[model samples]
Target: MKLSNEVKFNYPREDIWKALHDPEILKHAIPGCEGLTLQEDGSYDVSMSLGVAAVKGKYNGKVYMTDIEKPNKYLLEAEGSGSPGHVSMKMDCNLEETEEGCLLKWDCDAEIGGKIAGVGSRALGGIAKFMAKKFFDDIKKQLKKGAYTN
Candidate 1:
């Protein structure tokens, strides 16, 4: 599946970029995130329990940030598996400075297999979108709470 979106933040682009990489901020923002730990290689080990729609599962995954352009863009590659099934995804994120703050544009390509796929693509698409939006919105909230102060 392919998904994309744009989000505007009232904060500076730099702060938004940094906040995206901050483990604490992500854990606080990501819905159902139980843990987010940074690895020595710079990837993040993430654990999440999602209870939304037909995609409910406890997932353990590694998210790698690559092709990074500081304060501008990056790519996220992640793979995870649980009782529901397995998922692998690659997402590209871009940020543009706006007069108000920053404009974040992101797109993702995902492959899902197992029981989750049996739920049908339409339903899964909606669930994916819901989770993604909640994540971005929560990031904004975390930023507002001064989670990304330098």
Candidate 2:
């Protein structure tokens, strides 16, 4: 599946970039995230429990950031599996400085298999969009509360 969206933050791109790489900030922004550990290779090992429609499971995943251009853009690669299924995604994120703060735009391609894929593309697409929105919403809240500031 393909997904794309944009979110505006009331902070500078540098601050937003720092927050994006912070495991503590991500653990709170990501839905159902239980733990997030940064690895030596700059990848993150993540564990979370998620429920989407009739599918519910615990997922363990690795997230890697590449092609990073600090405070501007990067690529994210992730893969995970659970009892319900497996999923992998690659996304490109761009940060644009705005008058108010910054704009984060993302485009992603994802693949799924097993019981989760059986849930139908329409349902999966909706769930993906919802989850993306929720993630950004959580980030917005954290930023507003100064949870990610240095």
Candidate 3:
């Protein structure tokens, strides 16, 4: 599946970039996130529980950030598995400074297998979009409240 979207934040691009790299900020920003640990190799080990449509399970994943150009763009590659199925995604994220604040744009390619894939692509796509929106919204709220300090 392919997913793309953009989100605007009321904070500076540098601040947003710092928040994005912070595991504590991400644990709160990500929906259903239970834990996030940054590895020595710069990847993150994540644990999350999610329920979407007919799929519900706890997932353990490793997220790798690559091609980083600091406060500009990067690639996120993740792979996870649970009792329901397995999922892998590669997302390219871009941060653009705007007059008001900043805009975060992302495009993702994802693959799924097992029971979750049986739920149909349309349903899976909708679930993915919803989750992404929630994540961004949480981040925006945290930023507005000065939840992260530089």
Off by over 4 Å in 2: 148-150
Q: Candidate 1 residues 37-99, lDDT tens each?
A: 999999999998876465578989999999999989999999988888888999999999999
Best by lDDT: 2
Question: In model 1, which runs have C-alpha deviations exceeding 4 angstroms?
Answer: 52-55
How much lDDT does each candidate structure score? 0.89, 0.92, 0.91
Residue-level error in angstroms, candidate 1, position 62: 0.5
- lDDT-sorted candidate list, best first: 2, 3, 1
Point out where model 3 deviates above 4 Å. Answer: 148-150
Error of 3 at 9 (Å): 1.1
- All candidates: TM-score: 0.94, 0.96, 0.96
TM-score of 1: 0.94
Query: Over the stretch 1-150, how does candidate 3's per-residue lDDT look in tens digits?
Result: 999999898778998898889898899989899999999999999998987677899999999999999989999999998988999999999999999888999999999998899999999999899999989988888887876534
Query: What is the RMSD, in Å, between candidate 1 and the native fold over all Cα?
Result: 1.4
Tens-digit lDDT track of model 2 for 69-131 = 998999999999999999999999999999999999999999999898999999999999999
Worst 10 residues of 2 by lDDT: 141-150
